[model samples]
Every structure is written in C-alpha cells, then in structure tokens.
Target: MAEIEVYTERYEREHGHKPVGRRFWSFTIVSPIATAKDHFLHTEQAMTYDKALEKAMEVAIKRRSERIIVEP
Candidate 1:
C-alpha cells in the first residue's frame, strides 16, 4: 500500500464573509516508482479534517485494490 498524507486548506470566497464555511481536504499518496508520480485526492468540501481524511483513505484503499488486481 502507498503511504498517504492528508492535509487541510482553508477556503476563501470572494463575495462572502471572512473564513468562509467549510474547508478543503486533500491527500497525497507516495509513489512506489522512482519517478514518484504521486496520486492526489481532492474533495469538493469537508466539514472537518477527520471527514476529509476518511474520504481520502477510502479512495486510496479503493485505488490500491484496483491496482492490485491489474498488476496480479
């Protein structure tokens, strides 16, 4: 399995109040190859960091499973 890291970024809207509503959560999967072509998970929106992490992990697992089948 690829190592995954989750990060959160604050979202700022042009026409709204300061801070805005929800934030964006993203994840990056470390590449196994020497080229280091990492995979990224970008979500539409997330209320909390935990939620974002969960979504990212889910996607990573699914992708890993698919890759295993293809490689095997």
Candidate 2:
C-alpha cells in the first residue's frame, strides 16, 4: 500500500485576538496514487499546526485501515 502524505498550511485572518489577528492551521492528506486533478481524501483545521496534523494523520490511518478490511 502507498503511504499517505500530509500537508499543512497556516492562514491568518482579521479578528480580535493578537495584534495581527489569529492564526489558523489547516491540513490536507494526499494519496500517493492521486493525480493533480484528484481531491484530497480528508481536510481538517485546528488552532495549532500540531493539532491539525495529528487529526489529519488519524483520519488518514483510519481510512487506509478501512480500505483493507473485507466486507462480509
């Protein structure tokens, strides 16, 4: 099976928090077999990059494991 790849990006928006605003982190999981035109299997957002990445990895593992199971 191909390994799943995780990508993260940080976005800042205007809000009432810090001087520059708040920073939001988003994560996207890309399948190894996916093409440029293909969409990511999962996407998630969190207050911190680590949290977002953790969630993304969890989802990716779950999805990959499910694909390996046989339905009776």
Candidate 3:
C-alpha cells in the first residue's frame, strides 16, 4: 500500500488573496514513495471541498494509494 499526500485549497490565483469566495480551486498531490510523480492538479469544476476532494481521491486511486494525507 502506498501513502500519499494531497493538498487542496480554494483561492484566486490571479490576485493571490484569501477569501476568494469560491472563485477557484486547486490541489497538489505528493507521494513519499515513487509510486507516482508529485504534481499539482487544478480544476474549476470544484466549487466545494467535497468536489475538490473527489478529484484528489481520483488521483490517489490511479496511484493505488491505500493511505492518504489530506490538507486544506
């Protein structure tokens, strides 16, 4: 089983400010092992944390991760 780290957050990349009010969403995933390359994935489809988490989980699934560390 592989352990992976996923960082998900919502922010407006253009202004680089907080309290972006659900304007943008992005996530970064990292694996401690070489199960998969560490990278970032961004999507505008996610308006809430649940949606963002869903996408992150998909990546984890592809990596066959059994354990995951998620950060908001």
User: Could you tell me every candidate's TM-score relative to the true structure?
Assistant: 0.44, 0.37, 0.46
Candidate 3 per-residue C-alpha lDDT over 1-72 given as tens digits, one digit per residue, 9 for 90 to 100: 445544222333444553234434555555444334354556656466566666777876775554344333
Estimate, for each residue in 6-57, the C-alpha lDDT of model 2 and write its tens digit. 3211222233232122234433434444354432432333244455445556
Task: Rank candidates by TM-score, best first.
Answer: 3, 1, 2
For residue 54, model 1's alpha carbon misses the true position, in angstroms, by 0.6
For every candidate structure, what is the RMSD over all alpha carbons to the true structure, in angstroms? Answer: 10.3, 11.2, 5.9
Q: In terms of lDDT, which candidate is stronger, 1 or 2? A: 1
The best candidate by lDDT is 3
- The per-residue C-alpha lDDT of model 2 at residue 64 equals 56
What digit string (tens of lDDT, one per residue) describes model 1 on residues 1-72?
545543222222333332323567445643353133446556696556557656656656765522210000
In model 3, the runs with Cα more than 4 Å from the true position are 1-21, 32-38, 65-72
- Candidate 2: worst 10 consecutive residues by lDDT? 63-72
Measured with C-alpha atoms, the lDDT of residue 5 in candidate 3 is 43
Candidate No. with top TM-score: 3
